[model samples]
Target: MSGEAAPALGVLRRREFRLLFSAQAVSVLGDRMVAVALAFAVLEIGGSVADVGLVLAAGTFPLVATVLVGGVVADRVSRRAVMVAADLVRVASQGAMAALLIAGVAEVWMLALLAAVAGAATGFFGPASTGLLPEVVLAEQLQPANALRASAVSAGEILGPILAGVLVAAAGAGWAIAVDAVTFAVSAACLLALRVTPRAREQQSAFAVDLRAGWDAFRSRRWVWTFVAYFSLVNLLWGAWGTLGPIVAEQDLGGAAAWGAILTAMGVGALAGSLLAARVRPSRPLLLAAFTDSLFALPLAFLAATSSVPLIACGAFLAGAGMALTISIWESTLQRHIPGESLSRVSSYDWFGSLAFYPLGLAIWGPIAAAIGVGTSLWLSFGMAAAMTLALLSVPDIRRLPVAPPVAGEATP
Candidate 1:
């Protein structure tokens, strides 16, 4: 390797990257814990499977609706400021939910409202986080930087759910959610410590004009939109899995702890995948990413077919690994190809498209499972994931897009 090419840990040595990484790591752990705690919380309040779906949908709908505006705002302001503000918003929302749950006054509508607030924060955070990475690391270090971020997220997933499951068992979901609220506070503190370069000011323009420009940039890239379209369907399947998987675990597999184990296994696999992605550079990045993404179908199929935790864990592991690898490549590609000024906006479009049907899936999965059986619903979700991936591969751009050549000072892969 050329001396200029970053060693695996090289990016972490940078002060700004370290701060950013630490902030994200803590926040991700909290988010994972919340994922488990919230599901069980809804159920604990005499909620049915459909209730879980509705609560999740209520949260996600706002994210889907306002993400483009969030993107525009992120691009306009300091990314770090945007992230810090977003973190604080989540803290308030999660903290309120925790208070309500602990006091035994958390109605379904109350939970949904708090979740919507948190989701609105996420709409801003997601785009800013996507745009922030390139600013903190060198071009040559993008892969490792992305990998490290993914690794932090994976680590959080691995530990957070297990702890959350235990906490929920021991102290109730309220306490677990309370812990999530605190972590967001810590994340905001870390974000406040970072000193990133200021983004170039854009020419003042109408909001509609800026939105149109972002949309134009997104549509101009065939590969970007193609994969985004594919992911919309894939995310729909994921939404179903997210909504129903816990219920299945509770009913058949072994309850919250069993579901936690499955997620932990997935996180372990994702960690390994991120480590591998750091060192490997594929010639056909999108092609490989598309193939890796198809692995997500495995867990859904396994969940539908069997109630064995060990077997389901195996499938979840592969799915998580696939998702991590795909995310690393996809993020690096966007950073390399898209201009920084418009990166967040374009990323917002990508998020908007990819997540457009996610809330619908979350809303519908319970009813679908009820009507056609949980197993049938899962099987259909898996089938759709597989089909969408195959269809994505059929596109010339996705099949043929090559990884960008290394920068002049960097070693060729």
Candidate 2:
């Protein structure tokens, strides 16, 4: 086949890619559902706004704490096995959460504890997932592979919340959460079935030594850490939005259904963006990605400024498109530039840096909003997001990082 004409769609022909893709598709749908279910469940149990923030923080903090260690372990052991174990843990956590809610015996502390377990599992899952993609797809197909993954997540985002709204309205948040539990089970089964080619094992080293190596790899790259620092601020704003956006919908906008609609619109936008990213190869991928990230602030600004659903949804759509584009390019960039052996560890550091303030943001947003109205808090979030993006643009490496050309005989999309 001609180099440029090799089927871009051929990546799906691989058994492992298909399995991984299906697993992520099912799991992300459940994750989106739980995002709605868990938020409403906190509210349903007579929990205050601050309580919702606390519960989210309870989950996120542990995930942040454990992710670096999880990354180290993933690099040492079977990545697939680590993912399967993580999926099982989430399955149990969500199952317990669902049962408690169904029995009308759910308490705030109980929910928080279960959420923490699930979050810890996610810490391991995220790094392993970042590392595992390179094992499944050709090096030349990394962009499309990442785009396909984004596409699966986008599809889930589109369908999951709408289903969650229906399930929560028709049955209860418990039933919606139960669906999340089932999806994890499905994900575990898919992981179990994947037959990954094992890589040459590195010599066993002390845990601290391995961690230091990972840290070195992460800090050595200016481009990697610069954006990681930027995203730390961005994620904080995201946490605030995730924590307060639903409250806004319930209080000012329509309700859960309205919130779901907004999320679905974002998903649709992300889906479109993923499709575009699969086809379009930018010369300065990082520069373009950073520029797009500034768009994230728009939805927050719109939400803060007005209660217009159409305008907010439009902003959300743009923001989602930007997010999908950023993620597709970012993952592909990392996979290409970082060595395979150290990739998971570096990814852990990336996750750790980006998520460092997420829990803090989640913990404080409710009280901040209470002290100075939700609208004001959202406006502040928008301001931070915009400022961070601009700061990232000022970094030379981030602004000028070009896509590495195709290697000899490697097909170009």
Candidate 3:
């Protein structure tokens, strides 16, 4: 052979990746359940749109604040341990919420507190879990591994809302939340059983030093920063739309059941998109993916302009398809381009930069919606998101960047 043969696709055929994927599927299913339960619970408590937005914003605040730090921790400690601990933390917080509701002592404040706790857990878990993928799967099979994970995530999204509806209708939102708590326990068990040994680093650095290292890693790349800047606007609009969409459905279009249908359509479309991404390779993944951001704005416009559930559902499906394509391409890009040791660190910057404005978007969306009226505020969000997506196309580096072909026997950069 002229050089070492590229790692086989058989790397994804390993037992470890399957176990990790299964664990993540279970965890994501639980997350979806909590998502539905939390929204419904707030509505059940007679909370207004503003209140729901505030609560949701509070829940995601930690992502903006601590996700980068979480990446540092993931780089320092055992990634698996970080994931397991985060799941256990979620179990405790969710269990408390479940108990409060079951005892008829539940308050909006309780849900808010638990949501904040869960959010904090996600800050740690997200970076660690993302950083661990390359540790378990060979670089050659990263695409396939990501596809499997996306399929599982889509399936969970499809199932979770249906299950939440059934549980909420039959037993109440609290019971649905309890089911989520149990899934966290299952996830913890799965993660606990995994065995992964980190490679020895040439030099061990302090936490602050490691954080700077991560920052330097990010600042070093123009392509990386360009995408980060673009996604900031993307997340801002996305968070606003997500915060307001269900409320629009429930208050104006139909009720929770209709909202579930819309959500399911989005999930099904995303599933199809993930399957498609598994087969087709793109050259400039981030640049190509950023174009999909505009598709999401149309759905926001539909919800803003009309009360027709079917039209809203169609728009949601289109938006979801775009979102899935963007996610798959972007994740694979990260895996292929970034160094494994620093992937989490870079990903943290990606996550934090993209999402820093999300809480503000969510927090202000409700009041803004109220002031401008839901319909008008939604249109404004749509316009803003569309403009941002088009603006990203003008970034020369983003448009010109090409895929790094796999080099046999060479370490990833």
Candidate 4:
């Protein structure tokens, strides 16, 4: 709403970017909502907590396993076609889940199996999306476009769970999941409407060679790889906060509603940061993003030091804003620096690295917390992450990185 930010909205005038933006917004809304619906659905079928974990992991493991292949396929074919196909696949998977649940015959195994299918589709969708966006807009529009997209995701993060909860409460988990299925259909329709040409690239290489090229692209960039390495560890440490914070909430603060309020505050902060990202362009983008991202420690500190929900929520808000700025700038940096041909593949590598250790993080933090106590564990995680981030800042590659100059015309190199 600020005068400065109004200019960022200009990216929406581009017809292709607008349509892509809309598609991503709706799809993310569904994706976030389904996370809530799926867990509840497991319980609805008399499944235990372990079954919920199993179903969730089933979705994720497939995504990690197939994402590289998805990236290669995105590079070889039409990114739009890949995205539309992914969305349609999700429609099938989610719709089937909805149908099964509504019929009162859905089992934990059935939901788990269908979730794997949806996750596999997302594996393809993720990279194709990264590759396709650059094709549709002027290179200069990348930040604003990414920010707008982040805002949509942030909106989804805030509203999706709430929506799913309401629908589940009123109509049942089946209806909530059915709404998610409808969203994918909407995204598929939007993807089908877009008109853009992918940049030409040689596609005759064998699949192994293509995969190797992607790895080469990723490894060659010292900054990109190093950044990914730093986050891998940081995400690992964040598990402490995630594992311990909820326990603190239940014992000290009120409970689930309080935690939800804290999370909503974080989401609101992310939305605010997305707006700021739209307006401000940084010279040392990566460095600034890194600094903002390290602010995650703020929430960890709040959780360690206090039982006050308002104070802790404030810290959570700052952490969320930092995440928004980091993501918008980082996505723009990748699209700008990485070639269009290998962009998806390189992005898949980034995704793989970032996500690879998070499961481990989630697994280990609980035992660690049990051994040392939650408060000590949170503070330790916070301190270690801060020290590690400080070391990451000392790397010359991150400090010296510059924004890519704007493209001469509409096409990306």
In candidate 4, residue 186 scores what lDDT?
97
Superposing every Cα of model 1 onto the true structure, what RMSD results?
Answer: 3.0
Model 2 Cα displacement at 210 (Å)? 0.6
**Candidate 4: segments with Cα more than 4 A from true spot:** 1-3, 39-52, 99-109, 169-172, 239-257, 301-308, 366-380, 405-413
TM-score of each model, paired residue for residue: 0.96, 0.96, 0.93, 0.87
Please estimate how well model 1 matches the true structure, expressed as its whole-model Cα lDDT. 0.90
lDDT of each: 0.90, 0.90, 0.79, 0.83
Q: Lowest-lDDT window of 10 residues in candidate 3?
A: 1-10
Which regions of candidate 2 fall more than 4 Å away from where they truly are? 1-8, 405-413
Stretches of candidate 3 exceeding 4 Å from the true structure: 1-12, 405-413
Report the lDDT tens digits of candidate 1 across residue range 1-413. Answer: 55434566899899999999999999999989988999999998888898899998888998988899989988888989999999999999999999999999998889999999999889999999999999999988888899999999999989999999998888889998999999999999999999998877968888888889899889988889988988888888898789999999899987889998899999999998888788878889999999998898999999999988999999999999999999999999888878888999999999999999899989989989889999999989988887888799888888777688456696432
How well is each residue in 110-162 modelled by candidate 3, as lDDT tens digits? 78888889888888888888889888887767776787788778887788877
- In model 2, the Cα lDDT at residue 35 comes to 81
Candidate 4 C-alpha error for residue 15, in Å: 1.4
Query: What's the count of clashing pairs in each model shown?
Result: 0, 0, 0, 0
Locate the minimum summed-lDDT window of 10 residues in model 4: 404-413
lDDT of 4 by residue, 1-413 (tens): 56776667888998998899999889888876775677667767897544655676667667877789999999999999999999999999999999999999999999989988988888898999998988988898888889999899888767876677677667788987888889999999999999987567774899999999999999988889989998888977876665565467657876444665676677777888898789878888889988999988899989999898899989988998999999999999999999888999999888778766665565566667768888888889899889978988999888878887346673322
* C-alpha root-mean-square deviation, candidate 3: 3.8
Model 4: pairs clashing at backbone N, Cα or C within 3 Å: none
